[model samples]
Structures are given as structure tokens and as C-alpha cells.
Target: MKLNYKEDWPLYLIVLGVITMIAKEAVEVVLTPSKKMTSETNKNEWHQPSLYLDNELKGADREMVLYGENLIANTSYYFGPHGTIQPITNGMNCQNCHLQAGARAWGNNYDAVFATYPKLRDRSGKLETIASRVNDCFERSLNGKAIDTSSKEMQAIVAYITWLGHTVKKGDKPPGSGITQLPYLNRAADPGKGAVVYAEKCQTCHGNHGEGVAEGSGYGYTYPPLWGDHSYNTGAGLFRISRFAGYIKDNMPFNQASHQSPALTDEEAWDVAAFVNSQPRPVKDISHDWPDISKKPVDHPFGPYADGFSEQEHKYGPFQPIADARKVK
Candidate 1:
């Protein structure tokens, strides 16, 4: 009866092994399906393609400064009805608050701002969308009421901001401490030639002397005085020819029809801006975000909104280039 104990032990061991295998299989059967389902669900989630990723998107790689310049040039969006939604300070447009596509001395730069959205804001006390951020500008910055979240004005501003975001590398912090770069003549600029272009292309609205037109029917200065006591101060922005040129190239004239009425070449815009700034205007010390003129950039009208050069670089040339220009000759 006690014989063959080893053979019986082998059979018992085989049974134990089979039970362990069955238990392991049971645990997998309970857990595997849910994990696979989760993996599948994750794969099914949708993601929108970034506009910057599109090679065909016009101005994808355009500099933020250039885009800001263009937005200034094509500024009709800020002034027209539905643009600001309310008149906070002196019947101003978004441009008045932003001061040239948000490129003014103390104004906030709209570019690369979207990257921070869906963020928790203390003021709102909750997560906000990029649209909410634009609305906030309308209420707080512009001192105006909020526009409908889905309205055209909101959309246009969004588009402009979106364009700005594209100029910066996604997920990267925006460069420069602030808009410290000074405006410089593009390689294509010819100021002398720009004068003739100014006379022919700009005089009608801006006046031969760059005096702004009257308000009201003409929509408050049919042409904003390029340089004058009432005009944007020397530090306010209109002082830079390249910045002016960029704005005129995109959005000049109160009406979109007028903006599209006669298209301007970048060279022509540069020329006209130069011609206008070359004219005499009362210089005033306007309050600026960066009080240290030495620290400011020439190309960036707004304190921290512009890019493309260093603070030292902005101060050495652009505005002070008068002396350098003499040396070149």
C-alpha cells in the first residue's frame, strides 16, 4: 500500500500546477478586457491640427512684429461697430486700448497669449477659454463690455491672436523680456522713394502734413495724425517708420472697403511712413511701460509686445540711427 509514494507525489504536484495556472488565467480574464477598452478609448479621442503646422497657412512663420505691424496697418477691426462693444476711454477702439494691435508702449501683447489659456485665472475664479480671455480684454483692458462669445468681433480678434500664437514656437515660452526691439528699415525700404509714395498714396486721409482728419462722419480722424500734439506721442508708436509702414500695408482707412480699395506694397507703406515721420511734430515725453529709453527696442512700439532684436540693439539704432545714417554716407 505504501509502495510507489514518489509516483503519487508527481501526480499531486501536476494538479497543484494546473490550479495555479487556472487562477492566473481567471485574474487576467477579470482585468484584461477593461484595460484593452481603455486603450481603445484613448485612441478614439479627437485632436485638432495646429494652424502653425500647416505649411500653406499664409504668414505661418511671419514674425510677431510683422503680424502686429499688419494688424496695425489693417486696424479697421478695432474701430468699427461690434469691435470694442463699448467706449471706455475717449471713444477709443481696441486699437486705442491696445495701441496698434496691442503694440503700444504699455499695452499687452496679444501674441502667444493663447498658449496660456484654459488656465486657472484668479479673477474669473475658474478655468477660462481663449475666447474668455479676449472677453476679459474687452471688459478690463478696453474698459468695455463683453462681446458675445461667438460673435464675429470675438472671432476676428481670435483670428488675429491665433496668427500671433503661430509666430511663436508652440509650448515654448515667448522670447524677450518685453517689446524692447526697435523698428528698422527692412532691406526693401527706400525713404526717399517712400516720400513720393506718401504724397500720392497717403495725403488724402492723413493730409499733406500728416494732420489727422476731423472726427464724427469721418469716423474720428479719417487719418490719425502721424505726428502732432494730439497724435500718439513720440513714444506712443507712430514715431517708428517701419511700424507705421507695416500698419498702413494691412489696415489703413476706417473702412474695410478702403483698406482693400487700394492695396499698398510693403515698400510703399515703408516709404509713406518714413515720409510722414520725417515731417515736423511736437515731441512730448509720453508715459511708457519701459521708462528707460535706453532699454527699449526701436522696432517694438509696444514695450514688451515686439520681437526680432535686443534691448541694446533697439536703442543703438532705429531711433538713434540718425547719427549712424550720417556715418554711412
Candidate 2:
């Protein structure tokens, strides 16, 4: 007997639905492995925490944090050659070195400052406070005299640094808190090779003579001078080849690079640091630095080291030998 087609339509539809469900299950099985891999990769990544000073923050704490961030981001505006406030420092802001007021990861950030200070430092050879550390930068890096630690500006700066590291517990140094360390080269870094890299990659912003670009108002530098009377003095941390090279490896060419994807090779970073440091800049009296010569870093760039290496060897590398000698001792 022939079936009635309209009466059988619902039965046909149910069979079609069952076939569609089986096909979807087969497709999911094919995609499952790739989806699991993506989730695993995402779970392993780490990021620097965001800093906030919004409405939730109030009273003097908020004021201090806000002013501190402003001071760091605009240090040149308040303290540079033609500054409205002090006019004492070379025309470079704290952010020029600290990068994003010390919030950026592996960008010379202050992520460990609050947790680590009030501790003994090898450079100073004394128990130091956060305020003393800030003044150290003022004296050495800014090529200027120190401000009073009790002053509003100083307090604000300390407060901001503390706020940035609030999530970190005392005695714990979080990942990405400081400069990214690059491996040492087997041979001495070459100034001549660095000069070539500077001309090709750095000169457009930092200038042919390393005399960085000036702001329109003529008060501070838009791009900080790498070497000059207006640049950081000889006692600056960046005067060291290793420190400078690591800094360039993570952040350089003025925002063209990052820790995740650096623009310069390790050798190029070392060479460029050597070239920049070889240029003329203001000198600083560092007789008091590293009170114990034995405690001096392998790349201290000065004589009187416990190891008998020449000053030239100390400034540029093959620094692994010096480090090895220290380890043996």
C-alpha cells in the first residue's frame, strides 16, 4: 500500500536532524586538539599589572600618587635646564629612563623598589632608604644635585613608587621587575661597528652627534641626549656597557622595540652601547662609590677592581672572564 506523504513529513525531519547532530560531533573531535593547545599557550603568558589612581583612591594618598606620577613623567619640566621649578638637571625626564613612570615591564621599571629598598646596596655600601635611592639618581643620572627627602616632591615620588609595587609582598621580587639581562659576548664590543648602527638606526631621533631632539618650547628634550654635557653624567648606571646594552635590547629606537621582540641583535646592542658611552659627557666624582673594591660589578668601567683587568676590558666585554674570576674567588 502507498503511504500518505504529508503524514510522514515529521518522521523524515527527525531522521535528518539525527544525521546533522552526528556530523557536528565529528567536526568538534577534529578541532578539539588545536583548541586545547591555544588555551595552554594563553595560560602560560605573564603581563605587568595595570596601575590605577582613579575615583576609588582619595585624600592625600591619591594626591601624592598623582603628583608622583606627574613628576616622574615630567621630571625635565620641573628640574631641567630651563625648568619652571629648579632648572638644575640635564633636559631628560625620569620616564626617559624608567619608561612609563616605572610601570612598564623589563623597561627599567620600579616594580621591586618598594619591596627591596631599606636594604643594603653594593654601590653605596650602606643600608639605604627609598629616598636615598631617588637622590642617588638625581645626583648621578640627572647630572644634578639632590632634592630634600622631606620635601613634597620627594614624598610624592616615593608614594608613587610604593603604589606601583603594592601588589608585590615584601621580600619577593616579581618577574619583569627590572632590566632584561642579555647574554655577554665572547669578544669585546666594537665602537666602530656601533657607530655604523647609530647612524643607520639611532641618528634620526638622537642626532648625529648624540645631541637628542629638543621640545618645541625649548625647555626640555623630546628625545634625550645619549652623550653630551646635557646628557647623563659618567656616574650614571647607563654608562656601564652591560646595563646600557640590556636597556637597548629591551627598549630602544624610541618605541620601535620591546622585550618580546627586540629590534637589535645582542652583538649590535653591545656595540651600540660601547659607541654611545665612548662619546664626551660630563664627569662625576665617584670616589665614594663601591666602598669595597671587591664588591664592584664585573663591568664597573673603572680601575681599582679586585680583579686586575684593565679599565678598557671592564668598560666593554668579554666580561664573562671577569665574572668567572669573581666566581672562583
Candidate 3:
């Protein structure tokens, strides 16, 4: 046998494959930390909080805006069961839902509020003022009674939202003003799979029962409940899987998650949304919602829809069909 290199091709191939594997692992080990550190370094480069501190803005107006921010950041402190401000909310901070007191980008921010207000909302089917918007949150998201429009607390919140949008022109819609949406799934999200995700990632903060984690001796929560009496009502935006999925994909697992580095895959986000919505929470009357059924979202979750899909389909979906059929019409 005269050193037949061709006949030994299989051995050469195996050696090459082994070398390639080692090279890839080595590259990964060296580069992964470097990439992560670079990302960490650039974290502060994004937009600042755009805060107006007391020193920068003095007087009664400044105090009111700060109080408004406080109301949003700690709703329970001034408005919970122990609250001296008349106790309107169900012991959850507005920041619990708003995320960073409506400062964080794509965290259901209030940047568009000042400009977009007095606009028609399909849900209400009328032009709603900022006061109406705030009251809407109280009635549904907070599962609490509406605040009087002229009340000092309500005025403070409106002032804060107004200040948040101060830089933008009246008619201009600011980017990153609200929760960013995720691409619709081709199939229904799986609640069973979501249960596993919730256990591994969410249950620690939201609690094993989805009842939330209370902070200190006060009624406020460190992490708001995903479901139960204290959480947003069934009629809240979070009750819709479409809204909830986007919310989780952008912001979940507390500080460890964001839109840039979504800890959960799209599948995980959808599944977790399904799991959360399937749980029990307080209900609100939505008899007047979607006054024009044709204008309703594909994921509205309640029916008699304009299309023929079942209520279950609306709740958990491959919603492309519904959207497509509507588009054709």
C-alpha cells in the first residue's frame, strides 16, 4: 500500500471537523464576554430620564409635578388602603404597570399623551381628554374608582404627563411613546408551555399564585400580581394576549429583560402571556368596548366578532387570517 491519501480521506475529514469544533468553542468563549462587556459599556448612551428636579424647577408647580411622579411611582403610598389621599387603588403602583414611572422607552411611556389626547378612541368611541385617559386607567388597570377630574392628585398626574411630552410639538407623534408590538404568531400561544416559563422566570417575582409580592408593611407591591383580585381587571389592556405578549417581550423578569435583549424567545413570550391571561383576575364591565366590532383588534378575546372565528380563536390565535379577511373586506 503506497500511502493512499485518497483512501484515508475519512480520517482527514474527522480531524478537520474536530479542529473546527474546537476553534468554534474557543471563539465563543473569548468573544461572548467581550461582546457583553461592550454592550454594558454602551448602556448609558441611550436617552437620559429627562427629569426636572426641584432645584431646576422650583415653586408649587414643580412640587405638583414631583407629586405626580410620586403618585405614578408609588400609587399605593398615597392611594392604597392605608393611603391618606382617600385610598382609591388596589395597592399596586402605577410604575408596576407603566414601567419606570412611564420614563423607560417602549415601557408604555407617556411621551405621546400631551399631543394625542382629546382624540377619538375606538374603545370609548369618543374624543377622550387626558383626564378621561387617567380615569380609564383607574377604572380598569388599577381596578379602582375614577378620580375626580378637578382633584389635586388627578391634576398632578396630568401635569406630569404634560411635562413628559414638553419637548414634542403639539401635533407630532413621538417615537417610542408606547409599548412596542411583537410580530403576530402563526399559531396559538401555548399556556401549558407558558406555565413552565412562568415557573422558571416569572413566579419568583409575581409569586407562585400570581398574587404579587408586597413590599414593607405598606399595601404597595414590589412586583405587581399578574392575576387575582388586586391585579388589572379582565377588561384591562393586559388581559389581551396581544398586548401582554408585547409587554413581556419588551420588559419582564424585572431589570434583567428589555426589548434589546429579550430574555424570552417570541414563543416563550406568547406562551407566558397565554398563561397569565388564562388565570383569574377581577372583572370589569366591557359591554360598551369595541362599539364598532369591525374596528376591534384581531386579539380582542371577546366576541361576537365581525368575522366567523370562535371566541377561543380571538383569545389565542393565528390572527393573520382574521386580519387578512378584514383587509380583503
**Which candidate has the top score in lDDT?**
2
* Model 2 lDDT per residue over 113-153, tens place: 88888999998889999999998899888999899899999
- Best-to-worst order by TM-score is 2, 3, 1
Superposition error at 104 for model 2 (Å): 1.1
Q: What is the lDDT of candidate 2?
A: 0.87
Model-by-model lDDT, in order?
A: 0.50, 0.87, 0.84
Per-model TM values vs. the true structure: 0.38, 0.85, 0.84
Where's the lowest-lDDT run of ten residues in candidate 2? 44-53
**Candidate ordering by lDDT (highest first):** 2, 3, 1
lDDT tens readout by residue for model 1, 8-38? 9887788899999999999999999988976
User: Where does candidate 2 clash, by residue pair?
Assistant: none
**Judged by TM-score, which candidate is best?**
2
Q: Write the per-residue lDDT of candidate 3 for residues 1-329, one digit (tens) a residue.
A: 56568888888889999999999999999999978976774553224235544355568878888889988998888878788786877888888888888888768878778877879999889889998998899888988889889999999999888887776667765545677678888898889999999999999989999988898877689888889888999888888898889889888888898777778988899999999999988889898998998888888888878888888889988888888888898
Give the CA lDDT, 0 to 100, for residue 18 in model 2: 99
Scored by lDDT, model 3 comes in at: 0.84
